[model samples]
Structure formats: structure tokens, C-alpha cells
Target: MDWNRTKSIFIVVFLILNIFLYSLYVNRYNEAQSVEVAGEKTIDARLKEDNITYGVLPNSVESATYISGKVHTFTAADFTDPNHQANITDPKEARVILLSPVKLRNVNDDASFTEFVQANIKEGGSYGLWKVNRDERIAIFFQKTNNRMLYYNKSGLLKIQWNADNEVTMYEQTMLDNIEEVEQQESALPPIQVIQALYAKGLLKPDSRIEHMQLGYSTLVYLTQTQVLLPTWEVRVKLSDGEIEEYFVDAVEGKIIEIQEEKQEVEEEDWGV
Candidate 1:
């Protein structure tokens, strides 16, 4: 055998294989770019035709992981405070009703209200004020995990009902326990892509304005004792009729999530004040 000749032939074959692989990679990259460009143009045209406008879209891509937690069961031992009376409505759901009133120095002051919660409520520091309804005289707080809100999760909510005197007469609470990340970090869909998803689904109407877009977590699966949550994008839109609507999109799978309306109004009689 001709040693030099054999070595040269092997080298030539390796070079050919490398060239073939490189060409394939370039072709795939170009095709991906073309598809992305086409998608952008299509979305832009559709949005213009529908007269849809949006505020500044988030540009940075983010990664998140799936989290799971079990709802904490409330027991009499959990509430040892002498000032408030705690009623455990549902032990499995960890629902508690507080009957005693705790006056707030200033509900309008964030720091003051936070101090009140921390001093009066259990695991209160983990909750953040989500909304205040003056008509219902109620303030709703949601629990935060790793500094991010578990949006609209029933097992992690605190609802406080206050009288006209600015005294918190009653409240309902739920909490989650053993919270931990259940999956590896995965890249989430960008905000603009989520908008496009809503647009494609015909959820975005003509002359609508996207007011806000935020990343949060929504319940992906609910069980008897535990729940799984996924990264979600919450988009708030102002319709032409001046009505504000909120939509959620699954950031990982780009699917629209239909969230049922949770009643915020608490009857005066229910407060037992």
C-alpha cells in the first residue's frame, strides 16, 4: 500500500465531510432567518390593518423554570395571635378567615400598611399588595415566590376587608408551602411574540392599545394538595370602547390562557363586623 497516498485520500474525505456539514448549517440558518423575517412582516401588517397599537415591548429574552408547591393546611396552632380570631374554612385549601379587626394607621401609605401586615399576619412579609378596591372596601394581596408574584393563585392570596373607619375588620388568607423549582430553566417567549400570539388568536381587536405586559406565574396544573405553575405573560389592553382587558399567554408554549373571573366583592354581612 502507498502510505502517503492513503493518508492524502483520508484527509480529502474529511475535508469534504466538513464542507458538507458547513453548507448544511448555513442553509438551515438562512432558512430560519427568512422565516423569522416573514413572520415579522406578517405580524406588522396584520397589526396595522387592525389598528392595534402597543406600548414599548420588552426586548430582552428571559428564562424561567416550572415551580410546584403544596397548599399549606391551616390549623388552630398556626394562628396564636390573641388579637385576631382565625377561622379555618378549608383545611386542605388552607383557607382562613380572620374575624377580629386590626386598624391601619394609614392604608394609603405603603410602608405603614406593610408594617401592619408584617406585625399582624402570618408569613405576611411574603405578600405584596396587588389591588385595592375602594368600592368594595377591600385590599387584595398576593404572595410572592422568589420576588415574583404567583399571579391569581388561589392558594397564595390574602383578601382584607376594611370598614369606612379604615379598620381592617376581616380577611381571608391562603398560603403555599414547600415551594421549589420543578424543572430546568427554559427560555420564554419574548413579549412581542406573546402579543403576536394574541393578535393571531383574534384576541386583539381593532383600535386596541396594549397598556402593559409583565412576566409572572400562573397555575399550570391543580391537584388536590399541590399545584404546578408555569411562566406566563400578562398583557393588559385598552379596547376602543375604553374598557381594560387582561390576557395571559403561556410563555413557554405560547398558548393563550383563559383565566376565570375571581369575584373581589365581599358582602358586608360576610365580614361579620
Candidate 2:
């Protein structure tokens, strides 16, 4: 009937659709590369620099310490490993130590990848399996005290990541041979308490959904021999805009701590203007 009018309307609708699709793509792309942390701009590049590179993060002497029931006394032998490029701080409350990867490699995923990790980690020492992340090629295992899990901030008794070749590319760990002598076990803060604390801190936003939650042990101090870890609650959240974020709560104190992967909670900000 009205051929010219119909043609014009069709063109206008097509242009609107194109614009809408472009906006969606741009939003997702920006969200992937960058995020806001506690109202500050942050990037994956910055976090990765200080986070776990191969298996563990860089450890240094940190003056800051937290109060805990466990304590590790050290002198000078813990940092003497020159072969692994190990770095250790004088034993204190919450200090961490880091070691360079012994034989780092990047490989594709295959059948043997899981087997290598499982076997070597078992061979390294038997601990409770806390988490396994194939995406990042890392497996987390923790030390248990009195049937209660001890959670550290970013580390466990042992953390490992393998490549496609099934070679142990990165391995970082703390000593846990005699945890009882250095510390005592206490009831962990319940999961409900952690969730509430996260909500109070504006972590669980409106329209957000929980992706996963787990309990594990993370290291508080990297001592001469072992790391002292406590119970930790890990909560992964997917925001309304479809971005995944991880929140870590101290299972003992009901407070948030820095994870080795990421330590800051950034606000979702769009910088692609």
C-alpha cells in the first residue's frame, strides 16, 4: 500500500537496533577489562602484578599485622632457599612469603592435567581439597584444625596450578606439620554471618545473584616453615549487569580480607565514554 512510508520506517528501526546492539557490546567489553574497587578505578593488569603469578604471590616484610590466636616464631633459615627464589619475612603475625615458579609452562587442557595436579599435590602432602578452578588452572587445599577449617586471606597450606602439559607450573604453600603447637581452634563464624556482613558492606547489590559459596582455609602468616591460616568464607557474586566478582570474608572475625587473586572490591563504573 504505502511503499515509501514502509521503507522509511524499516530503515529507522534497523538503525535503532544497530545502536542498541553496539551499546551492549561496548558495555560488556569495558566490564571485562576494568572495574571499580571501593569507588576507585582498577584494572586486571594492576591486580595480576601483585597477585598469584604462577602459584603464589610475592611475599615481603609487611609491618601490618593482625591479632590471632596462633603465632609462628622464626629466625633465619626459612628464607634460605636460593633454588626456588624464595622470599620470606621475619616471622610475625600476618606476614607472607613468595617463591618463584620452579618450572613454569602454559599448556592446553587435556586428560592428564587433573591427574598431574591430584597426584603431585597428594605426593607433596595430604590436605583437604577446598576448591578447584580449571579456568585459572589452580587447585586449593587447606589444613584442618580440630575438624574446623582455618582460612587465610589469599593462601592455603598448599596451592598449585598446572599447564596443558600437566606439569606443575606454579606451587605456593605454607607449613602445617604441627599447627596445634602454634595455635588453637575456635568456632568459625557461620556462613549466615558472612553473608550479612557482605550485604552491609554493599557487596551484594540489588538485582545481583550468588554464583557460588564455599568455606576454606587461607594463610595469615608465612612463617619459617608453615603458614598460619584461618577459616575463610568465599562468596562469588554475579552483578545485575552480568559481571562476576568474588568476596572473601574472614570466617573467624566476620570481616573481609584481601584474596591473593584480588584484594579490593571495586564499584562498577563505566569508563568507556
Candidate 3:
């Protein structure tokens, strides 16, 4: 047997096997890297995708019907901060968000807060404010549409807050977001009709004096999970004994709506004469 020749042949075979193994390893490693890169596309590459093209959704009549008025644009790019971030979510859904003393000027309690809000919003400005509930320090104003007036906390409408000094300290608003302008603005019942409906419900007394009558949006259902705001007429009634009562009537249907009412306790008298 030729030992040197056999040894040389064995060495060559081993070298060939090592080269084949290395090639296989390199191919598998390359395949793994390729799969990882393909998992998530880069921003530029994603923009080029057939479905994505851009960030905005395509225009459709159905989509437009859900949104109202012109596309409102208000962004506080300067308000962006890591320490004191804004409490705004879903820019598409949140139309108006204003922080006090930030981009806000000339705010006062003497209806100035309401005035400032009216100036900010182009459509459905509050012509006559409907006074709802207020203490010595705070005053709230509601905007009136063609049909009825709406309050701040009622239907996610504009909420303006002014301090006792008559300067608008702060205000929170969520209008123009997902707005759907309908052709029918004059759909609600008038204030007089709303008052008659309240009388029909036995809520108003013969001597009940109407202190204030204003239109606003009422919360049909305001819950942590969901919310609904409907057009309503708010009437402040004062009885003969000097007691105040608040009544809400549906603006569209002219029906009385009672959310929560307090129970009255009367003293019983014994007739044991």
C-alpha cells in the first residue's frame, strides 16, 4: 500500500468537505439575515408599498359625510415637551385643544372667555350665551347654532372657563373633530315650544317664573366607555316660593328630558283632634 498517496488523498477529501460545509453555513446565515430585514419595511420602502403610498386615506363620499365643515388645522408644535406633555389624543378625533396662557390672549370672566372661543371657532359661534350652573369663581358659556345653543360640557362642545377676575384662565374644547355638517340646521323646536312641553310634563307650575331660557346640547349618555350629546333646550324656572328648577328638553323632538333629580321630603302632620 502507498501510505503517502493514501494520506494525500485523505487530506484532499477532508479539505473538500470543509469547503462544502462552510458554503452551506454561509448560505443559511445569509438567508436568516434576509428574512429579518424583510420582516419590517423601512419608512421609505413602506411609502412605496402598493397599499400604503401615503399616510392619508383616500377621499370618499362616505368618509366626507362623517366629517363636517372645512378641514380644521390647529397644532401646537411648540407645546411638545418631554416634561409637560399635552393631554391630547387622536389628533384626527380631537379638533380643538387649547391650554391656558398658551397661544391664548385676552381671556376674562365677563364673557371674554366666551368671546375668545367664538373668535377661535369660525363656524357655530356662540351669539347668545346660555347660563347653566355657576359659582362665584367660574362662568361657562355655550355656543348657539342655527337651531339651538350648546353648552361646554353638554355635547363635547367648546368649554370656556373664566376666573372671577374676568380673564379666561383656561378652556377645553373638542369641536370640529369628526364634524358632519348637515343641510338641516333648523331642526330643533323653538324655546316657546320647549317651555310648553315642560308644562305638559307637570314640571312647571302655574306660578313658575322662567328665569332663563337657552338652547344647548344635553348628554343623552355620558359614560366612561362611550358618550352621546344631543341638541336640547335648557330652561331655568323659579317657583313662587323662590326655589330654582332646571329643566332640559330635547331640541329636535320638543320632549322633556330628566337625567337626575333630587327627592323632596315633607313633614307629616297627625290629625288626632
TM values, all candidates: 0.81, 0.42, 0.44
Best by lDDT: 1
The best-first sequence of candidates by TM-score reads: 1, 3, 2
Q: In angstroms, how far off is 124's CA in candidate 1?
A: 1.5
Every model's Cα RMSD, please? 3.4, 21.2, 25.3
Look at candidate 3 and give me any clashing residue pairs: 68-179, 107-167, 107-168, 108-166, 108-167, 108-168, 109-166, 109-167, 149-215, 149-216
lDDT of each: 0.80, 0.50, 0.47
Cα lDDT tens digits, model 2, 1-273, are 899999999999999999999999999888865643322223223323433111222232112222233343433454444433332442431122224333333344343433444454322334455555676666655545544445433322456665565446555544344454344555566544555577667666666666666665556665545455555667777776788777777766778877654222111111121
User: Which digits, one per residue and each the tens of the lDDT, describe model 1 over residues 8-44?
Assistant: 9999999999999999999999999999989988998
Q: Of 1 and 3, which scores higher on TM-score?
A: 1
Task: Flag regions of model 2 displaced more than 4 Å.
Answer: 1-114, 121-175, 181-185, 260-273
Q: After superposition, how far is residue 152 of candidate 3 from its true place, in Å?
A: 6.0
